[model samples]
Target: MEMKERQQLQYEHDLRNHFDILSLSRLDRLKHYGLHFAKYAGRLARGDAEAKSRNETLVDAFLVALSAANALNQKLQNAEVDTEDAPSDLAFTDHAGRFADACEKIDHLEEFRSIALDANAAITDWIVRNATVRGVDLDALVDERRKQLAQRAVYAPGS
Candidate 1:
């Protein structure tokens, strides 16, 4: 076999042996969590905090989801999954564009924070509602996460 073929075979072998299928499964679960975090950040951004904090959290959540999806895409690429055969490959491209758009919004937060907050909340609320037909109770989730963080701080070794 050629060197490239040999390397491909080795990569496949290593992936099969070292990969945990559960990680791939978890990636799917993370999609919803990421969207939730984005929506939550949008809601918070409408408040008095600095623009950087608000934009950062929204961008961070989006990047995390994009990163997870990219990892899975890398595995599929290694397996030689034909792009034409996988509609998800096209979806991934669409997601990459969304990620880029989020980054661009972050770049302009200082000048447009208030406007961005309202727009972000509107767009994210629609997305959240579409994702979960009943819609998310943002206040409840925010309260729960805050409590969890406070509990962690109290039990932290340094404190």
Candidate 2:
């Protein structure tokens, strides 16, 4: 296969492996949420109207994931939940935090933010490149999606 094709395949393989690992670890909620993010990102890269309408930029997406990891870490540290459920959250939080913390210091508060910013940059580059290859007019798509979203907001319940 061509080098680009090979890279794409590898990316897909890595994503599947990561998903499998998360699922096997019984973190299905997190796995499903992550998968949805991936799927939405893919759709946006492919110029899907609804996905674009969601208005989730790469930065927004990265922040959401980072926030979840941070929340998990905080919850684990605080130990506000029952003991039986604490172990699993603690384990998952530690693993998630380690991705950002080179030293794995419990007090490394900004480590995850740095990781998330780097990840956002990489993901945004990848998505823009892929969307260009797909002949997606991102600016036009965003404009249209914004109009649709605005209309929806106008008629939305309690809005």
Candidate 3:
């Protein structure tokens, strides 16, 4: 199935499973939480305690969505969209939007964060295992890609 179709199905599943737990009325509320959290987090480094709190709250919601997606065997890269092409008005209609709501409803963002971190670490470990078996270093391949990007930047116009 296409990414959007998968997201739609996933959202439907999340709604069926967690809607009772969240007590949320609409998906848009989650979108609002995410949007406000991001906008606020940008100012968090400026010493705004409230913004920091809000930032964590929003992140918590995102983590909940991530957890749900993982449970449903969904791919994050497939669910994520290009920022420029993302719909501002229909924010509540996508996987990202559902994540925003989940984060907002989750009071303990730290647990969610740790879970995400662990998941990433596990993936890295698996990749390393497979690469070692094949006599390849994934990190070196990534570094080579980065070097190529840097070289391109150096030769680019007005650089």
Residue lDDT tens for model 1, 49-123: 545443333333333332333333322111222233312223333433353444355445533333333333333
lDDT of each: 0.37, 0.37, 0.39
Per-candidate RMSD vs. true structure? Answer: 18.9, 18.3, 18.1
Off by over 4 Å in 1: 1-99, 102-119, 127-132, 154-159
Evaluated with TM-score, which candidate comes out highest?
2
Instruction: Tally clashing residue pairs in candidate 3.
Output: 6
RMSD from true fold, candidate 2: 18.3
Clashing pairs in 2: none
Q: Rank the candidates by lDDT, best first.
A: 3, 2, 1
Using all chains and alpha carbons, the TM-scores for the candidates as numbered come to: 0.26, 0.35, 0.28
List ranges where model 3 is wrong by over 4 Å.
1-110, 152-159
- Tens digit of lDDT per residue, candidate 2, span 1-159? 222332343334324434443344323333433454455455444655554543344323333343333323321121122222212223323333333342232244334444433333343344344334545554455445434443544444444
Higher-TM-score candidate of 2 and 3: 2
* Pairs of colliding residues, candidate 3: 30-101, 60-103, 61-102, 61-103, 61-104, 62-103
